[model samples]
Target: MSDRPMTTTPPRPPAGGGLFGRGPFAGAGMLVEKSMSFWPSTRRLMRRLAPERARITVVLVLALIGVVLSVIGPRLLGWATDMIFDGVIGKQLPSGITKEQAVAAARAAGDDSFADMLSRMDVVPGRGVDFGALGTLVVWAVVLYVATSVFAWLQGYILNDVVQRTVYRLRSDVEDKLNRLPLRFFDGQPRGELLSRVTNDIDNVSQTLQQTMSQLLTSLLTVIGVLAMMFVISPLLALIALVTIPLSMVVTKQVAKRSQKLFVAQWTHTGTLNAHIEEAFTGHELVKVFGRRPEVEQAFQDRNEELFKASFGAQFISGIIMPTMTFIGNLNYVAIAVVGSIRVATGTMSLGDVQAFVQYSQQFTQPLTRVASMANLLQSGVASAERVFELLDAEEQEPDPADPVPPASRRGRVEFEHVSFRYEPEQPLIEDLSLVAEPGHTVAIVGPTGAGKTTLVNLILRFYELDSGRITLDGVDVTAMRREDLRSHIGMVLQDTWLFGGTIRENIAYGNPRATEEEILAAAQATFVDRFVRTLPDGYDTVIDEEGGNVSAGEKQLLTIARAFLSDPSLLILDEATSSVDTRTEVLVQHAMAALRSDRTSFVIAHRLSTIRDADLILVMDAGRIVEHGTHDELLAAQGAYHRLYAAQFSGALVTDDDEVSGEEEVAGVRG
Candidate 1:
C-alpha cells in the first residue's frame, strides 16, 4: 500500500434549490418561501417515487366533488327551510294542505325554488298546476344529500390511501438514506432523532394530510359559498355579517402566530424526550451495572417534565382558538338576525329572504370556526414538514463525479499522502498523515485513545473526506471512485459489531450473498464461530437478535470475522477487532485474521500489541501523524514510542504475574 493521502474536492451546489429553503428569508414572505419547500419534496415523491396520476387523480376528483357538494348542501338546507315556511305557515295550511303547499314542497326539492313560491300566486293558472315540478324539487333535495354523503366518503377513502401509501414510501426512502449516509452523520445526530423523523414526523404529516387538510379546504369553501349567497340575498345584510370576519381573522392570526412558535418548541422537546428514553432503555445494562438508576430516572423525569410543559403551553394556547371563533361566530349570528329582522319588518326585505340570510349567516360562521381550529392543526403539520424538510435538506455525502472512471486494475496497494482530516475543521483529528501498505501485506496501527487509529481506517474507506492531500487505491484517486463500487470491494469489521436481526447464516453471508452453505460453514469454522453455532439447536440457522445481543461480545466479533472472511474483499479493515474478547477468543480471532489476510491487503487498528506483533509493517500514530513505522522487531530495536508502549504493557504484565506467584508460593509454604 502507498502512503499517499486521498484528496477531496469541494462539494458542488445542487442543480436547484431543494425542497427545504436554503435561501435567505426575505421577511414575512418566509412562510410562502418555506411553503415552497413542500413542493420539492412533494414533487420528488410524485415524480420519482410514485405515479402522480393515480394519487393526484383520486385526490382531485374527491376534492372537486366534495367541494361542490359541500358548497351546495347548505344552500339546499336554506331552500328547504323556506319551502316549509311558505307552504305550512304562510296560509295556516293543515295536515292535508292545499295544492299550493304540495307544489311549494316540490319546487323546494329541485334546483329552482320558483315552483314552490309561484304556487301561492292568486289566480293560480289558467292552465292546470304542474305538481311534477314540486315532486322533482323534493327528489332533487334527497339526491343532493345522497351525493354529498358519497362524495364525503370518497374524499376520506382517497385521503387515507394517500396517507398510508405516502408514509410507507417515505419510511422506506428514509431507511435507505440512513443506510447510505456516511458514518459521520450518525456521529453528529442521535439515533432517536432520526427514528423520530421516520416515525413521529412522518406520522404527523400523514395525519394532517389524511384528516385536517381536507377539513381546511371544506371549511374555506363553505365560508366562501355562504358569503356569496348572503351577498345575493341582501348586500347590506351580507356586509353586516362580515363585520366580525375581519376581527375574527385578526384574532386567529394572533393565536396562530403565538401557537406556531410553541408548537415548534413542543415538537423539538418531544424529540428530545424520545431520544432520552431510547438512550436510557438501550443502555439499561450499563445503567444497572454502574448503579446509575436514580440519576438516569431523574434525567428522564426532567425531559418528561419539559415535554409536558411545552405541550401544555402549545395545546392550551391553540385550544383557545375554536372557542374564541365560536364566540365571534355567535356574535355575528346575533348581529345578522337583529339586522335582518328590521329589514323584513320594514317590508324592504321579504320574509323568505330574511330567513335565507339567517341560514347563510350560520353557514358563514360555522366554517370560519372550523377553519380556525384547522389552523392549529396546520401549525402542527407545518412543524413536522419543517423537520422532514430539514432532514431532506441535510448536507448529503458529496457526490462522486458524474462520469466516474474506475481504475484500470487494482492490486490493493493503498496510500495516504499528507492526508489531514477533522470532524470539526478547527479541531483537527488527523493531520498531515502519511502511510502505506503494500499488496498482500498485513499492516497494523496501534495507539492510545484519541490517537487517531480508527480514523485512519475511515480515511482508507473515504467515509470522510480529507482536509488536504490524496488517498489512492492502486494509484487511482479514491475521491474519483464511485462510493458503492469502492465499498463493495472492501470489507470492514467495526469495533462495535452489528448483526442485523436475522439468522446467523444470513448475517455471515451479508457481504457475499451468493455464498453457499458449504462456504459459509467453512468461513464460520475458520473464525471459530462454528463451535458456538453447533451448540445451538438450529445451528447456522439460529436467529441473531438485533446487534447480535443474544451472542457474547467475543462470539459477535467471531461472527464479524466470519463475515469478513466470506466477503473475500480486495482490501480489509479490522478496527479494534479483538479488543473486547478474552485471551482464548483473541487467539481464535488472530488465527482467523492471519488466515484471511494471507493474500489480501489488510489494515488492522489494534489496541492489543501482541495481535499485531507479526505484522509486515506497524504504524504508531499520535496527533494524526505517524511517529514510528516498521515491523515489531524493528520498532522494538528503535526504542521509540511503540517500544515504550510495548515495554510498559509487557512490564506491567510481568509484575502482575510475579505478585500473584509470590502470594501463592507463600500460602503453599505456610500450609506445608
Candidate 2:
C-alpha cells in the first residue's frame, strides 16, 4: 500500500541461524541437529501413488514370480554339483563295489571317520559320472534363470510407466493449485522458492521414484525367497544368517535417522539459494547501479556453502550403510561356512545342501544391503515431497458465486461504499472509505508515500477483498460476478511494463486476441508505437526478449499503452502510466490517453501535479482518508491539501501556518 513501487525482495536466512552456533562448520553441525516430519511426509508420499495401485499390483506379482524362479535356480545348480561330486567319487571307487561295501571296507581298514563320510555320500560305486542327468539339471537352471530375468524386466518396465504417470499428475495438480491460490498467498512467497518446488523438488521426487521403486520391490522379495530357501536347506545356517540381520538393521536405522535431517537441510538450503539467485538476476541492474555485487556474491556463497555441507553430510552418513552391511554379511558367511563344513564332516548334511545354503545366505545379505543403501534416496525424496505438499495444501481463494450476477449495462460506473481493508489485522490501512466514479469521468487520485495510493486502485480491480462493505461495477456487486467476467471489461496500464517473449504484434494482440490487424495498427498508431516500430527493421514483427532488453523503457511503456488501447474496456486504471516516458513522449501519451478515456470511467494514480491538472475531479488523500475532492481549480482556490501540494510542486518549498517545514511534512510535499 506504500507509494513506493511494489517490488519483491529475495528471501534471506536469519542471522545467527540454525541450531548450531554460527561458525565455519556450523552448517555441518546443524545437518543432523534438525528434525523433520519424516514418517508423516513419507506416508503422504505413498498415498500419492494410490491411483497407480493396479499397475503396482501387477509389478508385485511379477517380482514375486521372478524371485521364486531365481531362488529355485540356485537349488537346481546345487543339485547338479551334487551329481558331479557323486560321479567323481564313484569313478574313484572299485567298479562292482556297492556303497555299503565301500563303507565297510573303509571301516575295516581303520578309517572310521572316512567310512562315516562315505556313508553320507549318495554314490553308486559301480557307476561312472552320469553326464545326461548333469546336463539336464544345468539346462533347467539356465531356463529358470532366463525366466527370472524376463519377469524382472517386465516388472521394471511397468513400474517405470507407473512412476512417470504419477509424476505427470502431480505436476498438473501443482500447476492447477497455483492458479487457485489467492494473490495474498503469493505476497509473502518468493518467486524462486515457488519455482524450486514446482521444478526442482518435483524433479527430485520423479527421479527418486524411478530409481528406487522397482529396485526396492525386487530386493525385498529376493530377501524373502532367499530366506525361505536357506531354512529349507539347513535351519542352523539360516539362523546364523538371521543373526546378521539385527546388526544390519541397527546400523541402517542409526544412519538413516541422521541422514534424514541432513537431506531435509540440503533441500531447504537449495530453495534458499534458488531464491537468492532469482532475486539477484531479476534486479541485477539495480545491484550494479548500487555497487552491491560483492554483497550479493557473499550472500550466495553463504547459502551455497550451507547447501554443500548438508549434501555432503547426508551422502557421507548414508554411505556408511553399505560397507557396514558388507562386514556383517562377511561374518555371517564365515559362521555359515565353518558350521556347514563341520556338519558335512560329521555326516549329518550333504555338501550340495551346504553349498546351496551359502548361496542363499549371500542372496539374503545382498538384498539387505541394497535396501539399506536406498535409505538416503528415500529420505531425500520425502523431504522434497513435504515441500510440494505444503504448496498444494495452501489455502485457496474463496470460490466465485454459483450463479454470477452480470452487470445491467456496460456503462462504467464504479462505487465504493464504506469499504474497509488492511494488509494486517491490527494495523488498518484504509477504513470506511467511500468514493464514486460516475460514468465517463476521469478521476485523478494524488497522494504521498504510504498514503494507500496503489491499494486504492488494487481494490477497484478486486485484487483483494474488502474487510467490510462492497464494490460495484455498473450497479452490480463485484463479488457477485465471476472474477474473470469482471476483469474482462477492465483494462490496466501499470508503471512497470510487462511483455512476454514474443514479437511486438503478438504482445499487442495479447490484449484482444480477436482484434483485427487493422484495429491493432490503429491502436499502435494512436499510442505512437507505430512511429518507433516503423524505425525498426522488423516494424511490428520485432521480437522482444524475456527481459524485454531489446527495447528502451519508453518504448516498452508505449507498447503497453497500445495494448490497453486495443482492449477498449469500459473502465481503465492507469497507475503512473507516464512516469517512465520522456517529456515529448509524455505529451503524445497524454493525448492518446485522452482519446482512450472517451466515454469510459478512468482512475489515474499520479504523483506529478501537472499531469492531473485537467482531470474532471481531483481527490487529495492523506493517511488513508480523502481530505479534499473537487475540480482542480476549485481545490486550488480553496488552498487546502490539494493547493499546498500544487504550491509545493511549483514553488519547490512548502509553506505552512507555522512558516516551518517539519521532516514528515517535507517528505509528503516532495512525494506529492
Candidate 3:
C-alpha cells in the first residue's frame, strides 16, 4: 500500500443551494474583512487537541531526537576530516597517496591482514583519510540519517492521527453549533461566510498541521541544538554565528507584520468571491429571466478583482522573506569564515574546529530560512483557525431546561402571550402580543411586508427566544422543553421546498426513519404524490438529482406534503405550501391539506386571501400589532385591515396602507 496518510473533508453539498449562502438559501454579506485575535484562536485550537496530548508529546520527542542526530552528523564529518589532515602531516606523505602506501601503512600500524583500507581513505592529500576514523564516521552518519528517517515517519504517523482527530471533532462541533445557533444568527449572517468557515478555514488548519507544523517543530529543535553545539565547538565563533538571527528576525518580523493583514484580507476576499459565485450560479435562472446577466457578471468581476489584489499582495509580501533571510544567512557565513580563519592562524582554534563551527553555522541559518518560509503557513493557518473557532464559539441556543418537563400528549393548543421580541436590541418587532390557537383550530396570520409573520412561528419552534413572554404547547412552555422534543411535535412546509438528492423512497423516509412500507405508501397516496410516482419509470425508486432537479417544483412540494403526512405531526406550519403548484394541482393539494389539517392545530402564514378564506380565525397584522382578528366574512363586514387586504387582492390591485385601489399593479408580493 502507498504510504500516504488519510485525511477528512466535508461531504459535497447538493446543487442549487443545498448548503449555505446560495440562491434560496442566501444569507448576509461576507465581503468585508474581519478583525480576529490570533493568539486566542491558536490557544483554543491547541486546547481542542489536548485529548491527543500523549501522541503530540511522542511526536515532539521524535522530532527532537531526529534534529539532534541530524546536527551531530555534520560535526562528526568535520572531526573525521581533521583526523585525515593530522594523519597527512604525521606521515609527511606525497601529495598523492596510492593504494600500495595505504596498505603498507595499514599493515605496519599493527594489522597485517586488514585490506581495502585504501578505498575508505580520502586521497586528496599526501596522507589519505584516516581509514578507521573516516569509515566509522561515515557509518555512524548513515545510521543517524536512517534513524532520523524512521523517527520522522513515526512522528508523521502519530501527528496525523492527532490532527485528523482534532479536525473530526472540530467539524462535529461546527455542525452541532450550526444547529444550536439561534435563527436570528442565520437570518442576519451570510450563509456563504459560514460555508467558507466550515470548508476553507478548516482545510487550512488541516494542511498546516499535516505538513508545515511538523516542519516548524523540527526547525525550532534544529535552531536550539545547533546553537548549543556551536558554543561547544568554539564560543567566539558561536557568537559570530549568532549575528544572523537578529538580522533574520528583524526582516521576518517586518514582512510578517504587513503580511498578516494581507493574509486576512485574502481569505476574506476568497469568501466574498465564493459567496458571489454561489449566489450567481444558484440564481442564474432568475438572472436571465430578469435580464440581469450583465449586472451579475459585473458584480462577480468586482469581487474577483478584489480577491486578486489580496492574494497577490499576500504572496508577494511573504515571498520576499525566503530570499531576504537567505542573503542574511550568507552574510553570517562570510563573517564566520573570516573570524574562524584568523582564529585558526593564531593557533587558538584547530582547522577541524573551525570547519565544524562553519557547518554548525550553516545548520543554524538553514532553520532560520525555513522559519521564514513557514511563516506564510503559520499566518494563513491562524487566520483560518480564527474563523473556524468563531463559529465553534458562537452563542448557542438557549440552554435546555434542567430536568425538562416530561413528554406529554400534544393537543396542539399553541399560545403566544405578551411576547415581545426584536432580532436587534434597538428595533422591536413584536410587542405585547397575545394569541391563543385552540386545538384543531386553523389560524391564518396575514400581514403587510416585514410584519413578522414567519418570526412568530420561529418563536413557536423555539428557534429564537422571546424577550418578554411565553409560548406554550398545551400549557407546557416550549422553552421549558427540549428543543428536539418540541420540534418533534411540529412539522413545517414552506413555499421553498428542499429535497435531498436521493431516491423518492429515501426522501420521503427522511421524515420518518422507522416508517413501514404500508404507512409510507399510505402517506404518499394521501398527499396525491403516488399519482405521479406511479407514472415514473422507476416509480418510488427513481433517484432525484441534487436539489431534486429531476422533479418539477409542484411534484417536490407534493413530496414534502407527503413527508409531513408520514410524520403525523401534532402541529403543522404552512408558509404558502401550495404556492408552487399549478391551479389544478393546488386544488387537489388543498383537498389533501384540508384532510391533513382536521383535528390538528395548524398555522398558515399566507399572502393570498383566497387560500385562507376558510381559516377558522384570521389575524390581520399591521406593524407589530393585530389590527383585525375574525373569520373571513366577519373581517370583510368589519371593513378593517383584512377587508382592505382582500379587496386589493380580489380586485388584482396592489395593496397599500391607505386602502386605495388604482389600476396599476407593479408592486410585487405573494398573491396579494
Candidate 4:
C-alpha cells in the first residue's frame, strides 16, 4: 500500500480563469481541469451515453441564446415601467396620446395611485431628458417579456436533454466496471455498499448537474448582466450594491467548508446502515437460530442513530446558508435605498436610474445567495465523486503472464508442488506441502476443521495466489496459463451453493449459456435434482430467490451439482459438496459425483468416510500437513494415523480386503 492514507481534499474550483469571471469560477475551471486529466475514461463514458456531440453543441448554443434574451427582456420591462408612467401620469405622452387619453387612463387606473406616484417620482431639474417616446418603450418591453419567456423554456429543454443523457451514460459506465471487477475485489466489502456506488452516488451527481447547475448558471448570468447594467446607470450605486457581495461570498464559503465533512459522514453512515440491514435480512435464520434478535436490533439501531445524527448536523448547517444570505441581502437593499435617496435628492441621479440600481442590487444578491446554496450541493457531489473514484482506482488482481504456453492436450491431472499460502501474511493456512491427482483418479482429502481443505481447493483454481510453490495442470505450471482458459476446464461445486434470483432453467443454464433445454433436463436427472424440480408448481420454470432461499439446502446443492454436470469440466473440485444434505440426498450426490468423475480427475473433501472408501487415493491431513496418504485399504494395513482413526469409528469390526465398507470416520471426528 502507498504511504498516503485515504482522505478527501476540499473541492477547488476551475484552475484556469472562468469563461465569464474570476474567483470561484476560476476555481471551478481548475476542478474541470483536474477531471479532464482523466479524459480517456471520461471520454469513453461520454461517447457511450451521448454518442452525438452535435446534439450537445446545439443544446449549449440554444441555452446561451435563451440566457441572453431572458436577461435583456427583464431590463426592457423596467424600461417600459418608466416609459408608461411618463406617458400616462407625467403628462409626457407621445404624439398619439391626447389630453383626453390621460384623463381616461387616470380614472381607469382607480386605486393604483402608486403608478401615478412612481411617474411623479422621477425628475431632474435643469437637465433636458425627453419622455415623449415612452409609448414606444412600453410596446418594446411587452415584446421583451414574451421573448424572455420563450428563451427560458428553450433553455429548459436544452438543459434537460444534456442532464438526462449524462446521467444515463454515467450509470452505464459504473455497471460495466462492476461486471469486470474480479472476485477478490468483492471480499469483505458488503454488497449494499457496492450497490450504493451504482445507485446513490450517481444520483447525487445527477441532482447537482440538473437542479444545482441550472440554478447556478441562471444566477451567474443574471449577476453579471445586472452588475453591468448598474455600472452603466450609476457606478456609485453599483459600487454600493457590490460592497455586500464579498461578505455574502465569505459566509457561503464558510458554510460549505463547515458542512462538507458532515455530509460525507452522513453518506458514509447511510452505506453502513444499508450494509447492516442487508446482512440482517440475509442472515435472519442464523440470527433466530442463535436467538440473537435483540443483538441484531441493537446493532441496527446503533448504525441508524449514527446516520440520523450525521444527517441532522449536515442539513441543519446547510439550512442556515439561505436565511443568513437573506439577512445580508436585506441589509444591502436598505443601504442601496438610502444611498440612492441622497443621490437623487441632490439631483445627481434620476428616479429611473435609482429604480434600475435597486433592481440590479436585488439581482446581484439573489444569485449570490443561489451560488452559495448551490455550493452545498456541489460539495456533496464532490464528496460522492471522491468515493466513486476511489472504488474505480482500486488495484485489480494481477493478470496471468502474456503468451502462455498451451498444453499439448488437456489431461485430467493436477499437481501441487510445495504449495504454501496465507489469507493474511501473519498466519499461514497451508504449509509447504505437495500432492498430486493422476488422470481419471479420485483423491479424497480428509482434514480437521480449519485444516485448510477448502483453502487447498481454492488454490488449485487460482481463486487465490499461493505465497510459495507452484500448482500445475497436465505437468504445465498453471500460473502460466490464462485465467479464463484455466478455469474453463475446471468445475467447482462449493459447500455453499449460490443461485441468482431467476428461473430454475436460468440457474442451471448459467454453467453453460448455450446448453439446450434437453441438455439441462438430462443433467438435472443425472444429479437427481429433476425429482424436486418436477414437484414444484412451475417445474423447471420456477424462479429461485437469491441464494436459492426458495429451495431447501439439499435441493439447492443438487441443482448446483446439475450445473457442474452440465459443464462437464475435466478436473472437478467438490468441496464438502454434500455436507448440508441428509443421508438420502447425500446418496444421490455421491451417485452424481461418481458418474461425473468417471473419466476425469476428482478432488473430494468429504466428512463421510463411507463416501470415498473406493477412491484411488486418500490423504489424511492435520494442521496444514499431509500426515498420512495411501489407498484406503493400504492405509488401514499400514495401521498408522488412518488405521487408528478407522479402528476408533468401527471398533471390533472385522475387516477384509474384499470388503468395500470403510469406517465412517473423518479427520476432524478423531483428531490425532
Candidate 5:
C-alpha cells in the first residue's frame, strides 16, 4: 500500500465563476476570479522597503535634482529662440536706431499689432543676434540634459540595489515560513501551488519592482516639474493642458478597474495550470497505466486556454489607456498651440514662451501615458505579492517550549495514554487508543487499510499533534521535550524508500552526519548494503540518481536500513520496510532488521502476519481500535482477531497439533 496517510486527500480547486461569468472548467468551479485588495497589498509591499529607507531617500533626492534640471532645459532653449527671432527682425531695421524708436515708427504707420509684437520681442534695432549669448544658452541646455541623465541613472542604480535586497529578505522569510509550518498545513496544500508562490510569484514581484519603480518615480516627478514649468511659461496654455487631467484619470480608473481583475485571474489560472502539470508529471507512470493521457491532456488544454484568455484580456484592457491618453493629449496640444500663437501675435506672450509651453505639453502627457502603462505591471505585481503574503500569513505550528525537558539518557520506552486524533473534526479516526512498548522489545502492529497504523507512528514522531492525551518517551512527556531532541533518538524506515541525489556513502551517512568513515562502513556491512556496494563499479562511492533508479528496489531498502543502522537509534520504526522487495531480498532485509532491532524498542507496522510471529508482543487493530493484543502464540491460542487474520492469510487452515509443522511450511512457502 502507498505510504500516504489514509486521512489525507487531494486538494480541490476553489469554486466560483470567472471574470466573464464563464470559463474553462466553469462547471467544476475552476478558474474563479478573486477580488484583490490592491492598495492594501501594494502598501504592504512598500513597507517591505522600510529597512532601506535611508537609501530610498537618497534616490528620491537624486530624482528630484534630475527633474529640476530637465524642466529648466526647454525654458533655456525658448530664450535662445527669442534671441534669434529678435536679432533677425532688428537687423532688417536701419542702424543706429533704438528698439523703442523702431516700435514707435511701427505705431505711427498704424500697424498697432506689429508694434505690439515688436514690443514683446527683445530686439535691439539694427543690431544682429548675439551669437555669444545663443552659444551660452545652448551650452547650458546641453549641460543640464547631461546632468539630468546622470542623476536619473544614479537613482536608478540605487533603487535597483534596494529592490534586490528587499527581495532577498522576502525570499529568506518565505523559506523560513515553509520550515515552521506544520505537516498538516502541507498536507492540505498542493505542492505546485506552494512552489508557485515561492518561485514564480516571488520572481514576478522582483521583476515588477525592478521594471516599474524607477520608471514610475521618474514619470511622477516629470509630471510635477513639467506642470510647474508650463505655468511659468504661459498660464493660459497651462490651464488648457490641465483640462485633460480629469479625463485622463477617468480613463485610467476605468481601464485599471477591469484589468486588475483580469490580471488576478491570469495568475490564478497560471498556478492552477502549474499544479495540474506537476501532478501529471509526478504521476506520469500511473497516468499511463490507467490510460489517463487524454483526460490529462484535455485538462491541460482547458487550463492553458483559460490562462491565454485572461492574459490577453488583461493586456488588451490596460493597453487601451496609452492610446486614449495620447488622443486626449493631442487635443490639448492643439489647443495650446493655437492659443499660444494668438497670444504671441497679440504681444501677450513671446514666441519663445509658446515654444516652451508646447514642449511642456508633450512632456506632461508623455509621463501620464507612462504612468497609465505601468498600472498594468503594478496590478500584476501586487497580485503576486498577495499570493506570497498569503503564504507568509498562514498559521504556523505551535512553537517549541521555552524550557524543554532534557533527555540525559534514552532507553526507548514509549507509552500512549488515552490518545485521540482525527484529521477532520466531525469524523473521528482514532479515539482513546492506548498502547505501550517496553524498552528493548519488538511490538508489532497489524491492521487492515484505513486502520490508522501510519497515523499512530506519525504521532510518535510528532508529525501531527494529538487532539487529546499525551505521549511519553522514557518517562518524559514527548510534548515537554523539544521535537528535535525527541526525533534525534528515533530512526524510521518507510515502505517507500527515498534517497537524495548523492553517493551511496553520503546517503548512508545522512543518518549521522558526524559519523566517521569506519562507522559508516560498519553500519553498511551489518545491513547487507556492503554486499551490494562491492558489486557496483564504484563500491560505496557509487552515485545515486535523484529517483534512485540506478539501484534495484531491494538495494534502496538496504541503503535505508544502513542509514537507520548508522543512527543506532534507541527507538526504531519499520513500516512495511520489506514489503516491496522480492522473497530472496526479504530474507536479507529481515536479517538486517533483526540486527538493527536488538536491544532497541521497535514499532513494526505490517500487513503480513507471518513476519510478526516471533514478535514479543502483537497488536491487532480494527477501525482505529486495538481489537486484540498479546503474544502471537497467546492470540492464536485464544482464536481472537489475530487468529482470524492469520487464518485468512492461509486460506482458513486451522491451527492444530498436526498442522503446526504445516503452518511453518506454509509460512516458508509464502515467503518463497
Candidate 6:
C-alpha cells in the first residue's frame, strides 16, 4: 500500500460498475427495453436440461403417443357414427335397441317419418347391425383414451426428474463460481441481488422447463399429427383450416417481439428492488434513529411502481395471444363447416367424415395458442438465463501456477520491502514504505481512519495484489505460494465478527474441522470463550442462530478468537478484536492475547489508546505513511505524532468508545 496523500483519485470499480454511478443501483430503475430473439441463447439451456439424452428421448416418444391418441379419438367416434348409421339403415338396432322397440319408441314420440323409416328396412337378427364390430370399436376407443392419459402422467414424471437434476447442476456451478470470483467482483455487487439470481432466476428457468420449454417438442409433434389427420378426412377442409397457423403466427410474432422488452425490464427492476430492501433492512436501526422512514417508504413505493409498469405492460401484451388465436380458430371452424356441407350434399364426403374433419380443425389450431404462450414464457426464461450466465462467465481470479512452493518449517517472520499500493490507479495512497516483524514479535498499528492501517494488512495477506514491492513470509514471496496455502499460515479476527448457524463447538472447530473434543476445549479456554460458554446452559453444544444473534456481540467476538486459536496459525491479524467487549472481558482477552503472542507473530490494529502501551513496536501513521515507530516510552519522549496522539487520549479528549481530537472525531469503517 502506498503512503502517498490519501486524497488521490479512486481505483477501477467492480465488474457491474457500468450499471451504476457511485453505489449499487444508483439509477437502475431506468431500463432499455428492446426485444431480442431468445432462441439462440435458450438453446443452450435446452441441451443442458436433457443431459441424459435417452431419458428425454423416451419422454418425447410418450408425448407423441398422447398427441396421436388425442387426434385419433374424434376419428374413432366417427367410426361409431358409421356403425350406428348401418344399424338404422339395416332395420336392426344396436344392442341398446331392437327394431320393434325403435319403431314403437319413434311412434310414441309422434315421429311418423322416423317410424316409417324404421318399418321399411329389412329386419335381421342381432347380426344385421354388426353390434359386435361396434362393441370392439368402443372398447378400442376406451383403451386408447386411457393410454393417452397414462402417457401424459408418465411424461410429467420424467420431465420433473430431468428438470430437477439440470437445475441442481446449474446451482452448483453458480456456487463454485462465487468462490473463484475476485473480491472486487463482490465489492461491486449487492448481496441480495446476487442471491436473487441464485434463487428467483433459477426458479424461473425451472418453471419454464417444467411447464413450457419441454412442451415445445411435443407441441410441434401435435401440430404435425393434427394436420395429417385433417388431410386424411378431407383435403379441401384441411386447406381451409391451415390458414389459422400463419395468421396466429403473424399475430404472436408481432406481440411477443415487443413484449419481450417489457419482461427484461421487469426482472432488472426486481433485482434493484431486492438490493434496496437488503441494504435498507440491514440498517433499519440507523434509519429509525435518523427518522428516515418516510424517505425509505417513498423509495420502496417508487421501485414498486417501476416494477408494476413493466409487469403490466409485458403481461397485457403477451395476453393478446390467447384471445386473438381463439378468434382465428373459431373463424376456421366456420369455414370447415361450410365447405364440408357442400361436399356432403354433392356426395363427395360422408357426414361422419365431415364431423371428424371439424374436430381435427379445432384440435389443430388450439396448440397455436399453446405455442404462442410458450414463446412468451421462453422469452422470460431466457432473460433469467442471461443474468445467470453473466455471473458464471464473469472474470475469475487467476489460478495457482503450475508449480507452487509449499511452506517449509513454519516461521512467524514477515517483511514488507518498499511496498506501494493504491486503491485508485491515478491516486497513490501509499508510497515506498517498509516494515519487518520477526518471529514472536508484536506490531501495533494506530492511525486515523483511512490512513492505510487496514490496507496494510490487506496487502500483507495478498487480498489485493500490491502495485510495487513484495511482502514475504519467512523469506518466500507470498505471491509465489498458492493462495489457500498462504492464507493457511495466518488467521484473522475482524471487528465485524461473523458466526454461522451452528453449535458453538462446531463454529470453534470450523478452523480445524478434525479437532478432537479435548483440543476444542483447550482452544476455547485459551481465548476466554470458555468463561461465557460456562454461563450458557448448553455450553459448547449451544446452537448459534442467524449471524450468532443469540449471543452478545462481544461473545461472538470471543468465539471467533477461539476459532483462530484452534487453527494455531503462526501469524495473527486482529482488527479491533476487543472493541465490543466489557472492561472485565477485555482484561481476560488481553491476558489470552498476551499468552498467544508468546509463540505467534501478531499484528494489531487498535483504536483504543490504552490497548497497545506494552507492544514491542508502535507504528504511528498519518495520512498513509508511518511517521514514527518505536516503543511506547521512546515515542512519548520523542514528542512526535504518537506523543500528541497519546497526550490527547490521556487528557480525556479521546475515550475508548469515541475519541475527539482537534474538536473533531472521525467515524470508523471508512476506506481509502
Task: List ranges where model 5 is wrong by over 4 Å.
Answer: 1-33, 539-541, 650-672
lDDT of 2 by residue, 1-672 (tens): 123222222222333122222422222222222444789887888888999999999999999999999999889988887888888888889988789999999999998877887788899986877999999989999999999989989998999999999999999999999988987777656666678889999999999999998888888889889988888888888888999878988999999888888888888788777777787777677778877778678877988889999899999999999899988889999999999999887777778888888889889999898889898898889888888898898999888999999998888999988877777666677777788999889999997766777788888777788999889999999999998889988999999999999999999998999999999999999999998999999988999998899999999999888998799999988899888888898988888888878889999999887788779888887767677899887887676778777767766777576643453356445446
lDDT of 3 by residue, 179-293 (tens): 8887667755555666888899889888877777678888889999999998888888788888888898899888988888888887887776676677667777877887777
**Candidate 6 residue pairs in backbone clash:** 2-421, 2-429, 2-430, 2-431, 3-430, 3-431, 10-424, 11-424
Task: Count residue pairs with overlapping backbones in model 4.
Answer: 8
**In model 5, where is the ten-residue run with the lowest total lDDT?**
1-10
Model 4's alpha-carbon lDDT is: 0.70
- Over 341-414, each residue of candidate 5 has an lDDT whose tens digit, in order, gives 89988999998988988998999999888888788898999989988898899999888889999676788999
Task: Give the number of the best model, judged by lDDT.
Answer: 5
Candidate 6 lDDT (Cα, 0 to 1): 0.79
At residue 659, give the lDDT of candidate 2.
47
Better of 2 and 3 by lDDT: 2
lDDT of 6 by residue, 392-466 (tens): 989997777678887675777989888878876767877777889888888999977777887788887777878
lDDT of 2 at 254: 92
Each model's lDDT: 0.71, 0.83, 0.79, 0.70, 0.84, 0.79
Candidate ranking under TM-score, highest first, comes to 5, 2, 6, 3, 1, 4
**Alpha-carbon TM-score of each model against the true structure:** 0.82, 0.90, 0.86, 0.80, 0.90, 0.87
lDDT of candidate 1 at residue 93, scale 0 to 100: 32
Error of 1 at 275 (Å): 1.8
TM-score of 1: 0.82
Error of 3 at 508 (Å): 1.2
Which candidate would rank higher by lDDT, 4 or 6? 6
